[model samples]
Target: MATTDDSFNGLTEYCEDCDLETLHEVSVQIRTESTKEENAQFSREPYRVCECQRCGNRSSQRMNNA
Candidate 1:
């Protein structure tokens, strides 16, 4: 069998313990910014909770809409 690293591009993250960036899975998505105000300029930022594929450790990254 053969494997490829192409699929792991965006899905991978830096593993501190592993001393390298490895594949990760998105565990949960949390909205860091509130759009409930319903203002003229409402922005929403999201926090992506990711889990390390090898260690099962969790980490979060805030992503903004571009």
Candidate 2:
């Protein structure tokens, strides 16, 4: 349940500095784009707020759990 470095592990992605596409640190996030039903329920689309752990460059993507 715990990691030594406490760094969040994630899928591979392009990092300008890494070039090898290293891991990213997913941090706090915000959401938008609610569906009609979800809007009524006050739901919001998920988005990941991440940064390249190796370079600190930031990026974002839809938080698709699947």
Candidate 3:
């Protein structure tokens, strides 16, 4: 499974207020079970949440199915 930091690498740019102009080096893990309706194929994946280091801006990026 990919960690939040892994997803942060996918970030192409920083926010307007970002001073460092780079993604933070923090990892946040969130785990939950999905209902049948949510994942009909029973596919489980990790969702990444990232935050900016300077401006405290937050964003999320989902991993690709590949």
Best by lDDT: 1
Worst ten-residue run, lDDT, model 3? 1-10
lDDT of each structure? 0.65, 0.62, 0.55
User: Model 3 residue 10 lDDT?
Assistant: 46
Segments of candidate 3 deviating more than 4 angstroms: 1-13, 17-20, 28-43
Which residue pairs of candidate 2 clash?
none
Candidate 3 lDDT (Cα, 0 to 1): 0.55
TM-score of each: 0.48, 0.44, 0.42
Clashing pairs in 1: none
Across 6-33, the per-residue lDDT of candidate 1 in tens digits comes to 7753477677877777777775464536
Q: Pick the winner on TM-score between candidates 1 and 3.
A: 1
RMSD of every candidate to native, in Å, equals 6.2, 6.0, 7.5
lDDT of 3 by residue, 1-66 (tens): 222444536443456666444655445554444667667446555556767765788766656445
List the candidate 2 regions with Cα displacement exceeding 4 Å. 1-12, 33-43, 64-66
Candidate 2, which ten residues in sequence have the lowest lDDT sum?
1-10
Query: How many clashing residue pairs appear in each of the predictions shown?
Result: 0, 0, 0
Predicted structure 1: lDDT: 0.65
